[model samples]
Target: MPKLEPEIADEAPCSAEFTAYDEEHLVTYLRLLDAETDGADWREVARIVLRLDPAVDPDGARRCWESHLKRAKWMSGYGYRYFLKKPRGS
Candidate 1:
C-alpha cells in the first residue's frame, strides 16, 4: 500500500476531466471504494485509510471522506475512461 498522507484537502478537486491529483491518489480512491464495499465505518476509514482522527475533527474528517468517496465513485463510473485514453508510459 502507498503511504497515507496525514494532511488532506478538505475537498477533492471536482472537474469534468480526470486530474493529476486524481491519478496521484488513485490508490486512495481504490482503498476508499474497498472500505465502502466492506461496510467499514466512515470514522474508522477516516482513521485507518485517510489517516484522520474523527474524534479530533469530525466535520473535517467527514468532509474529506465524502469528497474523496464521491471522486472515487466518479473514477469507477466515468473517470476510468480518461485513464484508458492516456498514452502508456506517460
Candidate 2:
C-alpha cells in the first residue's frame, strides 16, 4: 500500500478538484471504505493502515481518519464525476 503523508491525513482540506495526490491514494480510500464495511475499529485502522500512532496523539489520529474517510466518501459519491469529465489520455 502506498503510504500517505501524515500531514495530508491530519489536515485534509478536501479540495474540489481531484488532485494527483488523490489519484495516488485511491487505494487508501478504497481500503477505508472496506474497513468501514467490515466494521473495523478506526483506532486499529489508524494504527495499522494509516500508520497513525493514536496512543501518541489520539485526537489527531481520529481527526486524520475521520477527515480522510470523509473525503473518500465524498470521492465515491461526487468527486468521481470530476475524473469522468477529464479527457482521456491526460
Candidate 3:
C-alpha cells in the first residue's frame, strides 16, 4: 500500500534506474493506468493520486503523470518481459 512520494514523482522515459524504480513503484504505475483507463482528470489525479498540486507546479505534475503513464503502458506492452526473465523471489 505504499504511495508515490512527491520527491521521486518524475519518472524517466527508460533507463536502468527507472526500471528499478518502476519495479518498486509498480502499484503506483497500476494506479496511474487505472486512472487513465477510467478517464480520470489528470489534474485530479495529480492532486489526489500523485499527491501533487497542479496549480502550484502544473508543468511538473503533467510531466510526471505523462512519463509514468507512458512507462506503465510500456510495462503492459513490453516491460512485463523483464519480470518473465527473472522469476519472482529469485
Q: Please, what is the TM-score per model? A: 0.89, 0.81, 0.80
Model 3 residue 90 CA deviation in Å:
4.7
Of the pair 2 and 3, which is ahead by TM-score?
2
The sequence of per-residue lDDT tens digits that candidate 2 reaches over residues 1-90 is 234532354655489888766666777788888999999999998887678899999999999899879888988998779778867766
Of candidate 1, the 10-residue stretch with the lowest lDDT total is 1-10
Task: Pull out the clashing pairs in model 3.
Answer: none
Q: Write the per-residue lDDT of candidate 3 for residues 1-90, one digit (tens) a residue.
A: 224552455654575333666666677778888999899999998787677899999999999878878888888788878756865675
lDDT of each: 0.86, 0.78, 0.74
After TM-score superposition, the amount by which residue 70's alpha carbon in candidate 3 deviates from its true location, in angstroms, is 0.5
- With candidate 1 superimposed using the best TM-score fit, by how many Å does residue 19's alpha carbon deviate from the native? 0.2
Clashes of each: 0, 0, 0
- Candidate 2 to truth, TM: 0.81
Residue 64 displacement (Å), model 2: 0.3
